[model samples]
Target: MKYEKAQEILPQDLINKIQEFMDGGYLYIPKAETNKRSWGDSTGIKKELNNRNNNIYKDFESGMKVDELSNKYYLVENSIRRILREHKKSNK
Candidate 1:
C-alpha cells in the first residue's frame, strides 16, 4: 500500500524530526512505529527505505560524495542528489 503523506500519518515527534531533516535538505522518515497502524500490511519496505536514508545521512555527514554514497547503497542516485541540493537551498 502506498504511504500517506508524512504530515498526515506521522506522529508529532516523528513529524518534527522529519521536518528538521527536510529543513536541512534531507527527505527521510523514521523507522515505523510498531504499535501504530502502518499504511499497508507491514511489508517492511518503508522501514528499509528509512534505514537506507539514515545510512545516507551518516555517509553524507562523513564527507562522502553523493555519487559514491549512492553507489555504495544501491539507491536512486538522483534522490540523494536532490536531497543534498534541497538541503543546501533550504539552509540559505
Candidate 2:
C-alpha cells in the first residue's frame, strides 16, 4: 500500500466532502470483491513454504534427525515434528 495524496488524484469537491468528516487522517480503501485474492496469492510466500516443507519431509525420510532439521531450518523441534506429522498425514 502506497500513500497517495487526495489533492493529487481526487477533485477538490470530493476532497472537501471527505474532509467534512475527516480533517486529516489516513483512509483505507479496499480492493473490489472480484479483485480480491486469497492469502499468499500475490506473494510467493505460500509456494516457498510448500517447497521448503517438501524438502524438510524429504530430508526426514532420508534419515535426518528432527533436531538437526530444526537447526538447519531455524525452526523449533516441535515445529519440525509437526511439519513431519503434517507431511505424513498428507501423504496418506
lDDT tens digits, residue span 1-92, model 1: 35567668778898787666565454544666866766644688877876667677778989998888878978678989876666556558
* Prediction 2 global C-alpha lDDT: 0.95
Error of model 1, residue 60, in angstroms: 0.4
lDDT of 2 by residue, 1-92 (tens): 89999999999999999999999999998999999998887898989999999999999999999999999999999999999999999999
Q: What's the TM-score of every candidate structure?
A: 0.44, 0.75
Query: Which 10-residue window of candidate 1 scores lowest in summed lDDT?
Result: 21-30
Collision pairs in model 2: none
In angstroms, how far off is 20's CA in candidate 1? Answer: 54
Any runs in candidate 1 off by more than 4 Å, and if so which?
Answer: 1-41, 83-92
- Per-model C-alpha RMSD: 17.2, 2.2
The count of backbone overlaps in candidate 2 is: 0
User: Best by lDDT, which number?
Assistant: 2
